[model samples]
Target chain A: MRRERRRVERADDVGPYRLLRLERDGLDAGEPGQFFMLEAPGRLLPRPLSVCLATPAELAFLIDPVGPGTRPLAALAPGDAIHLLGPLGRGFRLDVERPLLVGGGIGIAPLPYLSARLGGPPALLGFRTAGHAEAAALLPGAEVVIDPVLVTDALPSGHDVLACGPEPMLRALTAIYPDAQLAWEAPMACGYGACYGCAVELDGRLQRLCIEGPVVAARRVTGASTMRAGR
Target chain B: MIPVLNASGCLDALTAPDVARTLDAYVTKTVTPLPREGNPPPRIAETDVGMLNSIGLANPGIDAFLGEHLPRLAGLGIPIWVSAGGFSAADYAHVCSLLDTRAEVDTIELNLSCPNVDAPEEDALAIVAAARAATVKPLYAKLSPALPNLPGTAAAVAAAGADGLTLVNTLRGLALDPATLRPRLAAGIGGLSGPALRPVALAAVYACARAVDLPIVGVGGVACGRDALELVAAGASAVAVGTALFADPGVPGRIRAELAVLRGRVPDPGV
Candidate 1:
């Protein structure tokens, strides 16, 4: 609930994304699917980053430097002080037996932790091309799938699915697997539930992704186009 | 004494009950007569000193709020100040009449200036007078900083039976994306709140405090105890924490502590 100024321990480029490992004292070993709002100097709002990896002393994030909020994070160097507020949001419900983790592109950010929590379940990682697929190497033993085919096509039946990626992929996956739990991203003003800036329509009501979940049941979600547009 | 409360829509007490408990009082987001879906994507964008938002007052209608949210918010144990907003004076009176019967409701805050909505001219006196006739509970008018004559407006609302005033609301602003050169917010324009609006808030409080004898709840861009003290020095009876809540959920409690230390250090002026 408190924001802390943390120092970046390492910053490296992984294919099209930048991975930054931060050294934070009193850092919680956050649950898989939880995220932190990372703030750099000069930026107005902190960017929400899913916990790619978390340990007792360090936390890592895989950031796509596509927008203004995220582009500045790529320039962070070791010893740079970055503000963090987190381990926020309700993480994945890890109560099912034989759970399968599926990730597309940078949506793969939270899967490495989800996989570790599941005792390393076989994951299906999808990307636009082989170059972008290189980031899948961070996931140890994920089954890599390239463009023209979706990871959803290869989804096995009867296994509990957990997914995060672009809206189309999530929308497509949800149609096939209604019970799957999904991690959603919106243009969140407050990574906490205070402001309804990141609200998503679900079952005829608006739900805040920061509070109810960045991770939510796929069947409850509506208006995939709105989510895709990052409203 | 009500130390500090969060302005309406700034903190969602239902989701973060623990954080809600830390505040002196809880202010629920603006609730209208009918449910609103709010604006489209890119509803919020960060500015150089503050943030811009076009949330469109997205909230469940009064029926659901009273049935679902009010009970849960009352359970938080903090005093609940229900913020009511609508397109007409009748709408304000309608909602106030309903809340008047609820024992759990402590006060009513009339949101008169939601920049995103298209409504007829804001008649603060008419709204306060209508709500005053509907509810006996204390009523406060949350006014827009953009009002051309704040002091006269404050006097009119007070005479209309408003018990207090919330100094200022967010100022309308626009941001453009560098690459696309298009508006950054989907709503094209959004209300600005943060450190940027502090001076404007202070001026409003100073002017309104001298013009009217009613209590004023100062709110704009208070992120710390020092900021709260500044409003107090400007004649605000109490301050409401807004944009700062996003950065620090524990800010209200922290500001309370800081205010105590600040007061202790101030030399006593001869009475």
Candidate 2:
């Protein structure tokens, strides 16, 4: 929960997304599906970015620059100071012997970390086009699906599913694989439990996504209308 | 010395107990009579200079908060200021009365200015009066910055037996998405807080400090020690850090330390 100023080692453009490698010292090896709140200078709120890669000296985040909050983060250059809070929120639970990773669009942010932890699991990734499919390379043995078809339709049967993506995609996947562990994203103010801004409806109650989960059991999610992705 | 506290709903004491322990008093999120799911998602938006949120007074309700969180919060060894909100005067009274019996509770903050709710300015005095009759504990009416006559409202609440005022809650604001041409927040509008609202809060504290003789808890947009000092110089007896907690959880302690440094450097008027 300490805020630290980390230097950006690199900000590389990968199709429609940007990958930022930050030089953070003494950071814990983040668990799969965990995220950090990145605050650029001059933005009122920080963007919640999942840890795409974590090492002792550096942390990587895959970002989609859709709104004012994230656009600046994507435009970072080397040696820029970016403020960060966390390695926060519960990550994906990897308990099954056979794990399948599924991600849609930038929702694939946490899969690479999960795959690395599982020693490279099979992944099914979805994107708007082949151009946006470059992220699939991060996941070993991943099959990419272009638009007009959802990645959920390609879910391999009989494997423990770990998924993250847009709300509609998550909803569709949860219906088919209710036992999956989902990394949910919502427009958050504080990427912690304080603001209760990133609340999701689960079991007929509202839960803060920042603490209760960025990763949660699909069955507990109940539905998708309560979820709103980054603006 | 008056202790610096966090305004209700701004900090989750349970999640960050270490940070909460640093504050002189811990203010819980506003609890209503019954459980609240709060507003829909897209409840928060970032404006150019501040943040907007329509959390809609979300809480586990009084019973759950008192039962589940109060014991743990009491263990933190900081004075607990339970913030109570409701739809009607009686609701405020009921919640306040229940908290009055708890030995762990040090003060009750009557949240009279939640923009997300249909809380009327006219009800401020009535709500305070009702809660005043129900509890012997000290009461602080958290005021709204949007009120037309803030001094008059502050005077009314004070006359109704409120011990002090938590000057200036968030001002209502809206942010529209440029791409979709839709409201950024699902709630359509939310209360604005952060550096943007600091001046408004200072103005309210200054006027109210002159209008009423009660202690004032300056809130809204306090980010640093300088901001807190400005509010105190404007006549606030204490200040609470809010939206800044998002950027840095250690802000409260940092501001406290900075304030001490600022105070030590001040030359005595006698000299």
Best by TM-score: 2
Q: What would the per-residue lDDT of candidate 1 be over residues B10-119, giving only the tens digit for each residue?
A: 88897788889988789899999998888876677787778888999888889999999999999999999999999889999999999999999998999988888775
Colliding residue pairs in candidate 1: A231-B41, A231-B42
Q: Across residues A1-231, which tens digit of lDDT does each residue of candidate 1 receive?
A: 677888999998899989999995788857788888888556656778889977777788998888767778888999888888888898999998878899999999999878878889878989998889989988988888898888977777888999989888889889899999999888776688887888787776667788778899999887646562221
Q: Pick the candidate with the highest lDDT.
A: 2
Q: Clashes per prediction? A: 2, 0
Tell the DockQ for candidate 1.
Answer: 0.52
How well is each residue in B1-271 modelled by candidate 2, as lDDT tens digits? 4357897888899898888988999999999999988988879877788988999999888899889989999999999999999999989999999999999999999999998888744479899999999999999999998888999999999999999999888999988887788988888989999988999999999999999989999997887777888888888988898888877888888898887887778532120
